[model samples]
Target: MLKFNHLFNTLVLLFPIFTYASFNVGFKQINLDKVGSRPLNIAVWYPAKNSGETIAISDNTVFYGSRVIPNGKPLLSNNKYPLIVFSHGYGGSWRNLSWLAYELTGQGYIVVAPNHPGTTILNRDIKQSVQLWQRPRDLSRTIDAISIDEDLASYIDMNKISAIGYSLGGWTVIALAGGRFNTALFKQDCMTHSNLKACELVSDLGLDNPELNNSMKDPRIKAFITLDSGLARGFTPQSLKNMDIPSLVIGAGIDVGDMAVELESGYLQQFLTKSLSTYIVIPDAMHFSFMQVCKVGAVDLLNKESEGEGIICQDGGTRERTEIHRELSYLITGFLSKIFLNTAD
Candidate 1:
């Protein structure tokens, strides 16, 4: 019996162990030709079964990439995961928020992000970028495309959809949540505060078009979160007061140029009276803190490419960017759990 027991123990030790709570991330890219005037390139991240080769996503010399299983099969289960649509900041691409996407997927949520035409780093079309209204439309169309995607739709819970954005992307999600834009108000403010960062892009944003005042809200998005949104001053107080969805507005405490918290995130928090709004300020974080982690010597490399691009790696306080991301992840996950799971911590 002792020999039999020893053999059994050896067998058990040789067998691979698996944790039920842990999940591998899956990634894929697809293009939708009908999304707008240009084809929209989208990146999707989701909980995947441990069955494929792990690879680095969006890896570059300057930024560290997240590991994911390319085209890995979705976890085998009847459960449909919550969907989170991410909108990247101006001049950013779908990979900009990939860190957060991987985190959310690990927590059992599916994330989709689109590289906005003209505005994304991959494709910068001055004419297409100037059409500000098209930004929100890009997200709305992305949601539509995902909803009909046979492979992804089966794993997504459409009813539990949420939107998250950073910088100008934040403004895009806000518009998705029913906030109306007041072009005249924005232009007048720009005239007064000419030094404001958003004002510098007045011509590019096409603020003169009265049609921009029309509502671009998409009812499919149940909730939203914004990080240091730009062009927020253009949203009318009445429109913000009328939005009834739940929202979380996070601002970086460090002021960088005209993109101050007061003019953007603070403005949103102040006027979102009717929504179940929660506001937070990360004291150690800067606007670029929301982006992916930078590689060693990345600052110098970026500076070499462009005169002031190195600021992307700079932060406000002594804490490292990864630390800031951990705090943000905690706050964001906690808030989302309350809304999606209806549980309090």
Candidate 2:
């Protein structure tokens, strides 16, 4: 529902009142290099022994002051905690999901989020967006890097790696978990539903790449969680049926107006026969509501200066973003905990 501001490279740095949460957030960054692959900027968040200092975290478009213990001692869980990787949507930075990372780490999970080379906020090429297979490969490489990185490997239980993706990221995790995409499926939908936003995007961008059918399945990822999953038209019943891991699909109610609910989450819930998938449609939520909550006054400022770029800042009709985030974090933690720790509420 919102367009990314390409002209402005940055926004005014601001600090809003940050409430102290139940767990202290810690931060770390590392460079990931794979043979024949571009180096990636990876960010990590884990539970820390102390409440850290407030520092500016930039996402190209804006700077957020967050309280984080930089390089602080990670709170030991005795047993290796499960690893959760986060993937952001097209034209988004890894920090877009920082709220979720903080929540996950608080719940005793080590979180890794990497900025995908071409599709991130730093580079906004439509061609890179269509190269859908690369997204999952980016995640696989993160997994590879984590396995060998001495600092990360010791604290993470790589055996229980899971992923949480939003928008195109959802497609990435599905592909990583064995779902295949048939470009023809989307093409057919384009012919019948040309007025839909996704169909219009496919037509405008000419995204008929042959690599859409390739599978980027990574056996290490045991489960996936998706939100307002974009480009799911590429999936057919057979392709979705190939998935064997558990999945949680969260859809925005506002997307039902655009058919994304039906094409993506609903379809997966109805037809992904080989796995148990849980689907939840948040009533009145918008497509961008899945992203992190904006700081106080941030939405109004973006609207006044960025011309409705604040659309991403808005949430479901009058719903407090704080409440939404709290509910979602609880749901994600519970779902992942049940899977990885065998804990049930």
- How high is the CA lDDT of each candidate model? 0.84, 0.73
Top lDDT hit: 1
Candidate 1 whole-model C-alpha lDDT, 0 to 1: 0.84
Note the clash tally of each candidate: 0, 0
- Which residue pairs in model 1 clash with each other? none
Alpha-carbon error at 191 in model 2, in Å? Answer: 1.3
Residue 108 deviation, candidate 2, in Å? 0.5
Candidate number with greatest TM-score: 1
Please, what is the TM-score per model?
Answer: 0.91, 0.85
Candidate 1 lDDT over residue span 1-345, tens digit each: 011134433443343321124578999887999554678888999889898689998789999998999998988655678899999988899888899999888888889999988888867788888888998999998999999887788888888888999998999999998999998999888887777788888777676778789999999888999988988888999999999889988898898777888767888888886349877777768899999999999999999999999999999999999998876776676667668765221
lDDT tens digits by residue: candidate 2, 72-113: 777765677678888888778887788788777777778888
Q: How close is candidate 1 to the true structure, as a TM-score?
A: 0.91
